[model samples]
Target: PRSEVGDLIVIFRAGAYGASASPQSFLGHPPPIELTIDGDEIL
Candidate 1:
């Protein structure tokens, strides 16, 4: 699938471990924001 700017993409099975494994902070890139959803409700 293709993602455009401002698109909300969901990745399963990613948590603290995934963050530790990624290089998101490399080159000064900000870390990803985490969101929780429950049955159509965004928490």
Candidate 2:
């Protein structure tokens, strides 16, 4: 599947009340600041 041609929903498993260890996506570092999923960007 192409990364751009689909809807991406990032659900942070971390709690919203308690202090999170990392307020970013656990998938990687420098978490996603902004994301734009466009099929045009897909190769």
Candidate 3:
């Protein structure tokens, strides 16, 4: 398990509801862009 080139991997699952019950336009898929970081300021 080794990664390079921008390395930022996090896959710890227990019921990870990524994309919030994703059904993106009922499968047409195109609606998942909501980020709001405060520390480094990306809001």
lDDT per residue as tens, model 1, 1-43 = 8899999888776666655567777789888777766789997
**Number of the predicted model whose lDDT against the real structure is largest:** 1
Model 3: residue 35 alpha-carbon error in angstroms: 1.0
Query: lDDT per residue, candidate 3, 1-43, as tens digits?
Result: 8899876654335254656566677577787554545578986
| Per-candidate clashes, comma-separated | 0, 0, 0
Q: Model 2 RMSD to the real structure? A: 9.9
Worst 10 residues of 3 by lDDT: 9-18
Put down candidate 2 lDDT per residue, 1-43, tens digits, no spaces. Answer: 5566456655544345322444665556655444333555822
Q: Show pairs that collide, candidate 1.
A: none
Estimate the Cα RMSD of every predicted model relative to the unseen true structure: 3.2, 9.9, 11.7
Worst 10 residues of 1 by lDDT: 13-22
Candidate 1: regions farther than 4 A off: 18-24
Q: Which lDDT value does model 2 have at 17? A: 33
